[model samples]
Target: MTMTNTAPAPTVWATLQANDAPALIDFLVNTFGFIKTAAYADGDQVAHAQLDWPEGGGIMLGSYKPDQEWSRRPGTAGMYVVTADPDALYAKVRAAGADIFRPITDQDYGNREFGVRDPEGNLWSFGHYRGEPHP
Candidate 1:
């Protein structure tokens, strides 16, 4: 006998940062069709927020820290997010105040991806992670 366990595939999620989280969340919701599912807030300050995307997808967002230097800096390393539509998402992100690093292009490694810089200077790279579906 043969058996299989099937589940909806999971995609890569990005842990991003924005100096102005309220504005960032507003831009994401209004422009990219993303919705805030949950958040950790302090009065008017958004400590961390979760924005859900399609395909059982989501991203975790936070504010910039003075001592945290690696993840949220412009010239430093950042997070890569895999989405179904990189071009469309890139456009939405760019229109919502992100700085486009490059046009959406099919990468040599078998992904159509693009990179953009968020308000707090973190680079958000959107692409399709070329791999087998999760079991």
Candidate 2:
């Protein structure tokens, strides 16, 4: 054991709360191609769920409670997920229930990307790197 002066940015497992987490998780997996890695239910309905990203990260799903701030209101902002085919994934997400906020198009600065809003109003984005994405 030794001491070092270096630290990396925290990695987060983001979870969104919706009315029916099972349904929402299903949509993400069946439609957008996420894979279920873990899940738990409070009886028969999903209480907590996890989805594995095809590329690298992960997402969690849980039933929304009106008492929580993120649950009380719809989400307008969302973190983007990387995809090999952004255009195709965008179309798929739209077909499944996402509202297209911005059509897929190449940016002058870099990658081709699109914006969408989910059924519960959580913003979803799919994109890939042509160069770099701003952080």
Candidate 3:
């Protein structure tokens, strides 16, 4: 039997730790057009940052410090973002010199999507598919 909840879905957020948080912030903003909603820096390192998409959704980020237990391998998180216009976003990412991991294609799941790697090698994907509602 399938079980379903009627509660609203919780907002899901992702955080990435970059060696150069400030630079990463700039890169995300410049390349993906993410807006820095809030940022705190400790000198050259970004203590914490929150970047938001124009319509909705966002991600948290900070500088990677070996001292932190949460630090992961450099540039290893695979991220997916929803976009209103996958084609347009793909063009921007291409112009930004992103290394295309997967060229824009219509997925069997119905998403017109593409994937790329950021300057630090983190994988990111943008797609027009919004998954079907839970039953």
Task: Show where candidate 3 strays beyond 4 Å.
Answer: 1-10
In model 2, state the lDDT of residue 124.
Answer: 72
User: How many clashes show up in model 3?
Assistant: 0
- The local lDDT score (0 to 100) that residue 127 gets in candidate 1 is 86
Model 3 per-residue lDDT tens digits across residues 29-74: 9989899999998798888899988757889998888887888765
Q: In candidate 2, which residue ranges exceed 4 Å CA deviation?
A: 1-10, 43-45, 66-77, 95-97, 130-135
Residue 94 CA displacement from its true place in model 2, Å: 4.0
Error of 2 at 61 (Å): 2.0
Candidate 3: residue 30 lDDT (0-100): 91
lDDT values for all models = 0.70, 0.75, 0.87
lDDT of candidate 2 over 1-135, digit per residue (tens):
999646443288877777767777777788779989898988546767889886767787777677756564435438688888898887877777667888898988677999877667777777897345478
Candidates, ranked, TM-score: 3, 2, 1
Local lDDT at 115 for model 1: 81
Pairs that collide in candidate 2 are none
Query: Which model scores highest in TM-score?
Result: 3
Q: Give the per-residue lDDT of model 1 (tens digit) for 1-135.
A: 999647564466666666677777776667656778988978556777989865457777766565765446323447566688777787777776667887788888789988876555556677877466789
Error in Å for residue 96 of model 2 = 3.8
TM-score of 3: 0.87
Off by over 4 Å in 1: 1-17, 64-77, 94-97, 132-135
